[model samples]
Target chain A: MSHAIETIDLKKNYGSHAAIRGLSITVEPGTVFGLIGPNGAGKTTTLRMLLDVIRPSSGVARVLGETPQAGGPALRRRIGFVPGELRLEGRIRGRALLRHYAEISGQVAPGAVDDLADRLGVDLNREVRKLSKGNKQKLGLIQAFMHRPELLVLDEPTSGLDPLVQREFLTMVREARANGQTILLSSHVLSEIQQTADQVAVLSDGLIVAEGDVAALRLGRIRRVRASFTGIAAAALRQELDHLPTLRDIDIDVTGTEPVRLTATIDGDIDPLVKLLARHSVLDLAVEEPDLEESVLQLYGSSANGRNGEVRHG
Target chain B: MVRVLPVFRRSLGDSWRSLIGWSVGVAAALLLYLPLFPSIGGDGEMQQIIESMPPELVKTLGYEQIASGPGYTQGTFFGLIGFLLLVIAATAWGSAAIAGAEESGQLELTLAHGVSRSQYALESALAVLVKLLWLGLLAAALILALNEPSELDVTVLNVLGASKALVGLAFVSASLALLVGAATGRRSLATAAGAGIAVLGYVFNAIANQVADADWLRALSPYSWAYHEMPLSDGPDWAGLALLWGLGAVFAAAATLLLRRRDIIG
Candidate 1:
């Protein structure tokens, strides 16, 4: 499949510190691809490099088949960008900025910007500095989408937005995806990506830890298993259960502090524990499936070491 | 380009404040000119006052032919006013074209829309052209109104010379601001440099006029070239005017090259 955006060993350095190192990812055309990471994980820095706003120290990146650094005006015309911290002219009204942006982007519909503003509930007449954070985000989104660009690069797009507006924004993103627009969205928020992204790449310490189709990445990563036991004192049983090699942690208070407690972790493909528990007097046992949050945390979350879905902490 | 219209429109919109500010300067210049008009209208003290004034003061006011009846009104009266007008016009155009955009963060957004740094510089240069045209028209109207008497030929020539002078001066100012704006990220620094260049240009003009033998000094000041064009006293100095415009182009091109290399968002 032809990719809309791709980076090969992309690296960026700020003085002595590396914001992104040996980062590589491919985004297919017409798909929503998310770059998920914790704060300061170089997500925004990578986005800036892709948009040609920042230069990379090494490696190469291509946007729509053109080298971003040398790609001049012609290549930029095919892409739209929303910066992490958008600073617009304070004197100009929101509509004026939008109109100017559309005019500069070239070949956009007459009322396209106005319609977007209306739909986003952004008051275009208000000056940008006076607008609320959500309104400013709406303005930023309108500018990026108004030109109907082939590729949209948004950095921290839903910042300061209320949950309802964020939902609406995602709906807009879905509509864009339906129309065959490529999106490179970077966000620290988990639910935002889970609802929208078809593919996810988790970043940490300036490197991609894991990347794949969201379903494939989430399939085996999240762990949700609970077990209750008998024939042992409540405290002693909990203490003894912690010594088990497969089940390293057990929260006795949450698991009812009696002859029973619970342990959850990456399954490590161990079903013999269930068999061993069957031999014991078991009052109750539950093995709940893990959700996207658990899987994401397992992959990119700070607590997860640079391991392949091996989350030790329960 | 249609893309440039917004810069032009925004520049014009922002110019309203500068226009109001220049109006205040214009009022003061007109106040200074009012007392001299009577001297031109054949007042008794006209010759005595002309005889007593030092040549340095006359040179400062571009009053080479002050003994003539119309010289007082046409030369000294309008010359000082024209110089001040061009200064204000240039400052207004230059600041709006470059420093104002840097201050407002509009340059960052403007450059993001497939608009290259060179294109931004070109659009900004075009915006300055629009300002020159509008200000040229305003000065022409005012000059025409002030010169509605019998000597229409001389009056028209003087106004035309002033118009050309203002255009050249605006170029110098706009180009200087652009160069500073491209080099520095802060708007205040660009504006301060622009204003400093303008005041220094005026000083150079004064020095060159007082010491006419100082040909090197005259060549150094953009104003000196236009000052020699004195339509009320002599005729247009087309070569000097050409040189001023050439310098303006060079500065603007330098600004564009710098802008291409540096990051506007930074």
Candidate 2:
């Protein structure tokens, strides 16, 4: 199959409110595709429809080159999934739970589960219900990753994980992609997707606002940069930096007429801004990574929604 | 080659404790009420006491014939206490299998694997049937054990017949519960629907016994279909048993279909 996943005019409605409005995207096989959006942006809805956990109101989704309903259980055998809102409750120990899951999802080599558990450092001997949230998340990861399915669809996979474990998870993702597996993962955190995804689709308000290569989207991402200078007046600093493209909302403050402090959001590369500041005696600089919603708004706020490297599917 | 019905296996694993508890409960109810037949059974003063009550009340209670051996067994265990115990156990198992798992997110996770919707529901149906059968067989064995000791003269064939009828009746209730639970994904709603079927059936049968105009209700009530012939004393009602079994099958089928249509809510 040329595309591991493809959706055309995908739509879902919760009563009168349309949760997903005509979503369309295509992911090449053997690549990491990140679906990034804030909560309620319909990212979960789109991913769930692909997994056939939720049916679409209209349009079609083809995964692994088969319509989900036509593929049925046979198609799902080639997939591994982790729900966004995970709830696992049982009196049985985690090891038994994992074993049971493996038995249901086709075959797994002996010790496959144990190996994953060891890597995740999750104690599978404890009862599933009694384990902490992070531990339960680890167990979820092990189950999804153990089978080594052709397509892995994970939603908010690192919500409850510590940074160390999250790093380990990204490593696993990298390794999975290297093995020619297609990964479709959803996240509200920009950096998570930036670190693992080869291609990214930014979703907002039930629409794809931007889609492109990770580096392309990175350049399009808006960051609020604050800098202080001692040699230039606030007006002169604003005029000089303003000439450099990709800057907006320039706010400057001069308290005691000593150092000029300027705060503004830059849409594209910060390299030009840095070179311009090198000529002045720079004091302090703080650049902030906007949260997902802010970043999405900033993307939509610019021409990047179309001509700015946004990939259009065929 | 396949997973050996792995979904069914795991469901049973999760259900063993509750199934055992229910079996013990049905057995205890039978053991408690049957042995007393010796002291308070037969057509002597006990019949007078039953007669002294309001005619509607005696008929409603199914105490019209408590003197004969088979009559005493039917009146004490099969038609009354044991049926209640068995139906309660069935409904709980039925509702918990699908609706309970749905609420806890276990259903979504298991279902997202290679298990098809129909396959999962069918396996759940199998689990429900197997668990209910455990209680049914245990109830039959307990009553048979007390048959001679309690002066119950029920024939072995008739005892087994009545056990089958009781199980069939409970199966209808449990399947109804499973159907509603699968459709709604609400545990409380499904449990109520399951228990409602049995409760309404029992109450309708009682009302039909008193009100002559309500005779047609007996045909609609699974409870009446099960005990109308008093299978313990008069032999089994094969037609009625068939209807009960048939209705349970329809409900189970409908449940599987409904599960196939809805989304798996986490």
Candidate 3:
């Protein structure tokens, strides 16, 4: 299968500081690939390189099988991009700006911009400066998606958007995917990516710390498991669960001997924990994936240590 | 190849209010000044007053031969006030075309939609050129309308010649700003570069007119090429016109090349 976007050892440096260091990744056609990273993690830099807005210091990037720099405007025509920092012409009405961009691309179907605007709950007649930040973001998204390009590169697409609008925006992304459009979405929000991305790459300090299918990553990482038990003493439960290889930070609470509740986090594998739980009279159990914020913090903490070790060895 | 018409149209839309304001201002300046030429030209007392003034002051103000119709018009309007107004307009537009847009983050958004860097630079230059043309034509038309009434002996051909020179001079200034903005992506720097050129050219030409030994400086000043032959009375200076236009074109081309090779910073 042909890749929609590919970067091989892509690097961008500003003097001595490297924004992106030896980055390589690929997205298959019609798949929504998420680039999950915190601020200053080089997500914007990578997107800019792919758009050819800035040249890479070294290495190569190809979109739709063409080197983006060599492709010039022709290559850009086939891709739609929403910048993280969106600034529109304040004097022009939102619809007018959208029309101008549509005319430049020369590919949007008549009324496509209006349709997208309506779906996103944006008033196109308002001057951009008069619109709220969320409204302005909607206008930006409309322009990027109006032409229905084969690929979409969105940087922090949901920033400044309210929860409802963010959900609507994700719907648009999913709809775009259904139409066979490949998407590369970069964001610091992990849940946003988890909800939509087929595959995700976690970036830290300009390098990919982890990458895989979202479901697999969820299973492979830590999970918060809570259990409530009857006919079991809290002390016995704590003793039974002690030294279990898969669990950590174990906490047990007993309420006047009515019921015992156990809470702990499990890492790597859950099978061992499940066997331990089977030995107890479990009345209820809940297993939840770690929230995006916590997941990112953990990833960063672990990666920092790993990087420090590498630095020492080098 | 990336259709620049959209950019051109958008530029006009964004700036039409300023264009209209400038047009009105140029008309007002012309109508206010041209009608005074008849009274000013025929007044013997005023002529005596001007003649008694210091020669250096007369030369500095470009009123060395203001007793005649063509000389009065050149001294009061074309050589002084009109040139300043047009150059100011050109400089503002040129700086805004790339540098202002880049600073505001509009350039990045526009380029992400398939417009090449070269196309963006060229279209922006073209937009400034067109707006400058509109202001130039407004000045010419107003002058033509008041020509017979003001008893100014300048012909329609001469009026057009002067307007053409004004446009050429403004184009050179605008293109220099455009080039600097495109290269540096800084509006203040572009403004400084354009204003510096205009001021330097004017100072050089003014000093050259007063000091015979400094005549060589005129060759290096765009201001001299514009007003040396007194285009309103004499026909357009073809060589000077060619030089002004050639400089504009060269600067515009250089800007495009520089824009294509450099990274666009926000």
Candidate 4:
């Protein structure tokens, strides 16, 4: 598949610090590519470089196969971008701002801008400075998606929006994807892309540590079953299960007089264990499946994990 | 070019009513100067007083070449009007170019779009040109209506020459503002710097003209060669006019180059 956006060893420096160091990424056309990372993960820096808002210290980037710095207007004409922060002239009405952006971005289909504004529920007649954060985001959305661009680069697009609005925004994204628009979205919120992205690139400290199809990355890392049984000798059961090999490496709890809970990293094919449990009285069986939240934590290890096991992906 | 017109219209719209109000007010003020015209003639007491003053002071208010008739009056008219209006126009031009963009976030947004740095510079120059032309036509019409026909005829050619010179100087100030605006990325500083350059140019011109012995000082000001013979009083000096035009063009070119190379959001 053709790549809509590609970066080759793109690096950005601020005096002594390297914000994005030797970073490279490629987003395929017609794919909802998610760029996931914590704050200060160089996501914004990467987006800025792609848009040519800031020049790279070294390396090259191509948007739609054109150097972003040189006449990329043709490419830009077909791309939509929403920055993390939206700052505009507060005095001008939202309608005027849209008109200015529409004019600057070159030609668009007739009445398309207004239609998008209406869908986004933005009051274009209100002065921009007076609009709330969510309204501003809506306005930004209108500008970005109004032209029905082939590529959309949205940075923390859902930042200040309510859950309902965020859902609507996701629907917008889904619709864009359905229409074959390539979306390269960066967000600290994992759930934002959890249902939207086809592929995800996890960025950490300016590096992409893991990236692949979201389902593939998340597969095979789920929780194992932990079952307890009553009316059984804990030691005897442990020995029998160990001998069976299917229930090997079990941690038995023997303090209770009734039943003992055993935890194990269960592999596939549990038919034998099921047959064995039928012969004895199984009590308080609990199977805990490790969620994608924990999988991400285990991938990053402790220092980067948020709140121990309490995933705060947003 | 098509892209710049809407922006130019919107920019003017932002201050259109007020600018028109001010223009009418200025015209009325110019009418106040009409009664003083007869007294400004050679035989009047005011003219005698002007004639008696030291040549340096006389030259300061531009009274040296009254023998040329209404051309003399018309020349001072263009000069004074050009100087004052250039200041106002430069402020508008600079503030609109720099602060206006910064304030509206349009500068950031436009720069973010695939607009090349040179294109932004060119569009901005076009906006300035539009404003200059509008003000030039106003000045020309007023001068023609008020000019004395019995004395020296202020022909359309003279008006055109004088108007072109005024437009050149206005553009020079505007181009300098854009350069400063792009460099500093602040509107106020750009306005101040643009206005400062115009005032400095005027002062340098006056000092150099007063000290005729100091020929080197003439080179210090861009205006030194700009106001030769005064408009309508004598045929326009093509060389001086060309120099001002060339300076404006160079300033505009330099601004575009710098804007292209710098990071705008900075």
- Provide the TM-score for each candidate, comma-separated: 0.77, 0.93, 0.88, 0.76
Q: Give the TM-score of candidate 4.
A: 0.76
Q: Per-residue lDDT for A80 in model 3?
A: 90
Q: Which tens-of-lDDT digit does each residue in B214-253 have in candidate 1?
A: 6577777777766665644465668877887888888889
Candidate 4 at A185: error in angstroms? 1.8
Please give me the total number of clashing residue pairs in predicted model 2: 1
Q: What tens digits encode model 2's per-residue C-alpha lDDT throughout B1-266? A: 34688888888888788877887788777778778877777538787788789998888888888877787777767778878887888888889888988888888888788888899889988888888787778877887888788888878889889989988998998899899998999989988998898888989999999999999999889999999988888898999899999999999999999999998776
- Candidate with more favorable, higher lDDT: 2 or 3: 2
Please state the Cα-based DockQ of model 2 relative to the true two-chain complex. Answer: 0.64
Per-prediction TM-score of chain B? Answer: 0.81, 0.96, 0.97, 0.85
In model 1, the clashing pairs are none
Model 3, residue B58: distance off in Å is 2.2
Indicate the worst ten consecutive residues by lDDT in candidate 1 chain A. A305-314
Candidate 2 per-residue C-alpha lDDT over A1-314 given as tens digits, one digit per residue, 9 for 90 to 100: 56999999898998899888878889998999999988988988887888788899999899999988888888888898888888888888998898888877756877888888888899989998899899999999988888899999999999899999999999999999999999999999989998999998888777787788888765345888988889788777877877977899988895748888889989877898888888999889888988988877655745323342343331
Q: Give the TM-score comparing model 2 with the true structure, all chains together.
A: 0.93
Residue pair clashes in candidate 2: B42-B67
Candidate 4 C-alpha lDDT tens digits along A1-314: 55888888788888788777776778888889998877887888888777777788999898877778763556677778887677655567888777777776746778887887766677889988899888888888888887888889999998887887888889999999999999999888776777799888776666665677776654234346688788888888787777556443578888857667778755445667667767888876665555444444556644343222222222
Which digits, one per residue and each the tens of the lDDT, describe model 1 over residues A2-116? 6898899899887799887788889999999988777877888898777666678899998888888688667777788887777664566888777767766756777888788
Ranking by TM-score: 2, 3, 1, 4
